[model samples]
Target: MTPPDLAQRLAVRERPPGRPVMKQRWSRLLFLHWRVDPDLLRPLLPPGLHLDLHEGAAWLGVVPFRMERVRPVLLPAVPGLSWFLELNVRIYCHDDHGRPGVWFLSLDCNQPVAVELARNLFLLPYQHARMRYGGELAATRYHCMRHGEEAEAVYEYGPAPSAEVRNAEPGSLEFFLLERYLLFSQGRGGKLYSGQVNHTPYPWVPADCGKWSTLPVKWDGLPEPQGAPESALWVDHVDVHIFPLRRLE
Candidate 1:
């Protein structure tokens, strides 16, 4: 199997044009987690990766409204008892041409079920992804996370190919822009949001990132896929509406 070539793939080379200089053409990630699973935990986290899901209970992230303005939304900072948040992250190495390389999931908790879902999200044996010159690149839906704080997840995914499982398909996915809308009660914060699928441009991202936003949703009904086992399972998705979405202007 093509074990992820972290060294070769992540090695930073001179910035190529059309891509960001030093760091460019990548996606920004922001996930919130409280309790975590053993298998789904990272040794360390990257900085500048934080979300405030306290004040405004937004559906997705800071959904930009005007152009450079965005509203404030609170993130679930409470641990245990009734707080669960997860978001699988994907940052691309944008290029004038060809495909980008990136993948990850972020969420709260470190439960066994959550770990399993995260594992399945990014990992795909051998399926080394290779994108043609011109074609769709993103995926359809985000990782459907189940269980946790008992909240429904409503999220979406842009068309972007990964190095492993769930790569590009036949047709191209399309995204919409909700520059002006309502989020919970934060009121139209005079910001803007442009949704793009399959064709979302890549921004600049750091390779050796300290903190990340990718996380996974676990199964509460099933007894930790390890020591014991059961049936029932809960699923989740990228609920951008839950959190406030803002453009990185």
Candidate 2:
């Protein structure tokens, strides 16, 4: 399938009008992506989404980040319930309307309440995991292991260099990976749904990695990632507003 037009994709950045249902901050994110054949990902998607490709290659990402101050729109953040660590194995896809978004294979978080809420309300594949984060700004370490499973990943990363910090050029691979504003998921009773989140374009920087592993992807039923990632990026922070999920009729 032809990739969505770059200009059209980039044009959909405006926040959908209305009060958002949720608010949160995603910080210290490490994005690791690998290029794969589109055919390998087709069957895994739900009924209404088409695998989104860039330059004819499908991309899968493993993102580990700190999730903070997550709460419903009008509610105050509750201590233990509001913050946690998250690791997701995701792929790029576009819905029937040609709106590109993420399709999560699994979202593992340290908070069980958040896992249950996401699984039941958003129809996402969320799992409870034991997770931790430490180290300093220049170098950070992340680790997670899903309950009752061998799925886990451990890695440390830091910024690439001063020269490598820049915005993603429009239509570039970096833009394709980091600019997504929508997410698609399969809801209860096999219904397909989409949710929107708005955030400023990521202040992306090339990143260097140490002691990385692809166990999360393997746990999602895909083959182990081969070789080094085609892209590794770090975004220090992005505050996000999440709209309510809507059924795709």
Candidate 3:
């Protein structure tokens, strides 16, 4: 299969032909990624997808963020249902057609309705979790414990004082990891499906994440990650437009 070219990467950012199905605000995102052995992840991917590598290495990401204003198009945000926290364990991947996207192993969310809706509507791996978020801009704390789990994933992070805010360079590893706009999921009968999300390019900075956990990755049935994460970035916020899921075979 051909590799995803810059043009293809840019193409996914273009608005789809129809109206967006939902609008959401993703804020206070902390991205923690580790380099994983490709052999370990290959067996976990659904059929038709290959691991998307950067410099011959496979990457896994653990992202914890706040979700706000999550409402259907033309609908107002419901006070309780629209606000929540989520933490996802994902890997970079590309379909046989060479379209890059994220393949989630597990998505832990605090809102029960959102979990059910995403599982049924988008075919994602959404799990109900007890989560909490708090703290000021300079310092933040996030915690999540999926139902039936004996331990919780906790994160305490803040901005890296010397790091600067900027968009990732086009051909850099940062761009490869943060620029994904598509996602792949397995629906009923193990059929494949794809969904697209459009948002401004994320402006990221190094994170002073003194506390991070690898439980989410282990919870997904992968080998436990050792040592500190190779990369950690922070994004204050971004408004996103979510499109409908499409059948991919």
Most accurate candidate by TM-score: 3
List the pairs of residues colliding in candidate 3.
Answer: none
Candidate models: Cα lDDT each: 0.22, 0.88, 0.92
Considering every candidate listed, which one attains the maximal lDDT? 3
Mark the regions of model 2 whose C-alpha exceeds 4 Å error after superposition: none
RMSD of each: 20.9, 1.4, 1.0
Tens digit per residue, CA lDDT, model 3, 80-195: 99999999999988898889999999999999999999999999999999999999876899999999999999999978887889998887989998999999999778899899
Q: Which digits, one per residue and each the tens of the lDDT, describe model 2 over residues 1-249? A: 445687668866789988899999999989999998888899999788899988888999999999999999999889998889999999999877778889999998999999999998888999889998999977899999988776568989977757456778888999999998888888667889888999899998887787677988887879988998989999989999999888897
Single out the weakest 10-residue window by summed lDDT for candidate 2.
1-10
Would you give me the overall lDDT of model 2?
0.88
Off by over 4 Å in 1: 1-139, 157-249
Worst 10 residues of 3 by lDDT: 1-10
Q: Predicted candidate 1: what Cα RMSD to the true structure?
A: 20.9
Instruction: Please give each candidate's TM-score.
Output: 0.18, 0.96, 0.98
Model 3 alpha-carbon drift over 4 Å, by segment: none
If ranked by lDDT, best first, what sequence of candidates would result?
A: 3, 2, 1
